[model samples]
Target: MTPRIHGGGDHLGVARWDFSSNANGCGPCPLVLRAVQEADPSHYPDPSYAALRSALAGLHGVEPARVLLAASASECIQRLTAWRWRAGDRRFWTPTYAYGDYAHAAAAWGLVRVKEPGLAQLAWLCDPGSPLGQGESPDAVRTLLNQTPRTVVLDRAYTPLRLKGDSALSAEQTDRVWQLWSPNKALGLTGVRAAYALAPLGAQPDVQTLESLAASWPIGAHGEAMLRAWTQPEVQGWVAASRATLTQWTQALSDMLVGRGWAWAPSEAAHGCAKPPHALDATALRARGIKLRDAASFGLPGWWRLSAQRPEALTALDTALNGLALEVAR
Candidate 1:
C-alpha cells in the first residue's frame, strides 16, 4: 500500500502558522467546544447511536433509517469500500484529484481503478474537492448518479466550509448517492473524530450491512457530544457566520501570495492551491514555525494547498517567506 500523506499537527508538533489542514479558521465553535468539554466520558455512547442518528436525519429532513454512523470520514470511506467489494465490486473510480482515503480504501480491497465512472462498481466524489476545491460539472454529477448498480459515495466534508458557490448536485440528485459528512472540520474540532453518512433513498439494507460491519460503539463520549452538538441550530448558525470571515481571509491570503509571485488556482472553497514562482523548500518553512501541504500527493507536484487562517497567522507566513527569500538571495 502507498504511504498516506497528510497535513496539520505532524511529528514536529503543530506549526505556529499552519496553512495545511482546511479546518475552519474562525472556529472551534463555542457551542461545540463546550459540548465536547462537558461530555461525560464515564460511559460509552449508545452502541446503536439511536438518538444521534435521529437528530442528524431530522436536520437533513431524511428518515432516521437512512443515517449511518461511523467513527470518522476516513472510517466511512474504508467501510463503504469494504461493504461494496464484498458484494462483488471489483472496479472503483475516483476524481482526477481527490482525498487520498477514497483511492486508498479502494486499492486495499484489490479493486481495479477505472478511468471512467461508467466502468466502475464503486465510485467516490468530493465536491469542492480537496487540494483544488473544484468540482465536476453538474452534468457530470448527474451522469454519475444516473448509473445503475454503482455505489457512489459523495463526500461532503467541505460543504460547510465553502466560502462561495453551491453544490454541483441538487437536493434530489444528492439524495441518489451516499452523502458522507464529517462536521468536525466545520466545527473546527477535528480532534473529536465523529462522522455519519446519509444513505441514498432506499439504501437501508446497505446502511444495515455497513453498520453490522462496524465495531460496536464506534463513537465514544466526546465524539458523541461533538456530533450531537453539530445538529444544533446555533452550531449551524456559527458555521454560516464563519464563512464571511473566511472569505475575507482567503482573499487576503490570495492577494499576498499573488503579489509575491505565486499563481493562485481559482477555488470556491476556503482552501486553495498555488504554485510559488520558485521551488518551495518545505523544510526551511517549517524551521520558521510555518507548514504547508505539498500538493504532490494530490497530483500537483509544483503547488501547495493552503487554508484561510487568521490575520496574525497570515502575517507570520509573510514574515517567514521574506526570511526564506533573504536566505536565497544571500
Candidate 2:
C-alpha cells in the first residue's frame, strides 16, 4: 500500500525534498544554456548526434556507437518496455517503488506488472532500491543480471551516483546492462528532458524500433537545444560545483540525523545511496509536520530520503525534524 504523503503535497509544488529528489538550488546553468544554443532543429540532430555521443562515450570509455539518446531515461525505459514485452507478459520489479508510470504503460498495452517474481517474463532493475537511494555493488549487480532468467531492463537512474567514487555501468562491458543516466537528478536538467542509454556492442535489433518509438513524436527543438548545452565546458564546471553543493547538503542532513540520535545506513555515494539509520521511523516523522518521503514506497519501509536544498530550507527541515522528536517523546 502507498504510505500516505503527510500534509498532502500541493499540485504545482511544495517543499521539493518530499520526493527525495536532487537540486542545486542554483537555477539555470549558463553552460547548459550555451550547449543548447547550438541546437538546430532545422537540421535533424546531425545524422547521429556525433559530438554529443563522443563526449559521453569518451567519458564512459565506450565506443561512440554504443550510446543512444532519448528525451529522458523514463522515455528510454518505455521504449525498451515496448520492444520486449507483450500483453499479459509479467513485468517484474521490487515493491513500494517508482516506475508506477512504467506499470501504467505496460497496462495500457496489456502487459502484466508483477511486484514479486512469480513467473515473470521480464524484469526491470531499479538500483539502490528506489526511494531509499541505496545501491548494490557492481559484483552484486552482475550476480542479479546473471541469475534472473528474464531479460533485465537496467534502470540505473540513481546509480553511478554522487561526485566522488560514483559507479556507472560500462556500456562497452556488459550486454545485459542497458543503463540510463538522468541529468535531471544528477545535473539538475529537470526541465531539460535529456537522457541517454547504453546497450551491448552488438548490432541492435531494438535500435530502429526504439528510435522509431522515440522519434514518433517530434523531439522538441528547445529540448534538443537544451541537450546540446549539456556538452559544454562552462556547463561541466557548473556541474562540478553543483555536485559539491549536493555533497555538502547530504553531509549536513547526515550530521543532523546523528546529532538527533539517529543513524544512517552505509552509503557508497555521498548523498544518494544512503538508508536511514535503522531507528529513523519515517512513518512516525509524518505524524509531525515533517512531510517525510515514504521510503516504504521504494521497498524499504523504515528509511527516508531527502534531496539537496538551499541552506535556509535545510535549516527549516532541521527545525521540523527536531520538533518531531519532541512531539514523539510526548
Best-fitting candidate, measured by lDDT?
1
For candidate 2, the per-residue lDDT at 151 reads 56
Question: Over the stretch 56-108, how does candidate 2's per-residue lDDT look in tens digits?
Answer: 77766777777778877667766767766643354544334554555655655
- lDDT tens digits, residues 1-330, model 1? 645788889999999888999999898899999999999999877788899988999899999999999999999999999998899999988888888888888889888899888788888888888999887667667667774768888999999998778889888889889999999988888888999999999999888899999999999999999989999999999999999999999999999999999999999899999999999999999999999999999899999999999999999999999999999999
Worst 10 residues of 1 by lDDT: 135-144
Clashes of 1: 0
Question: How do the predictions measure up, each by TM-score?
Answer: 0.98, 0.72
Instruction: Highest TM-score: give the candidate number.
Output: 1
RMSD to the true structure for each prediction, in A, is 0.9, 5.2
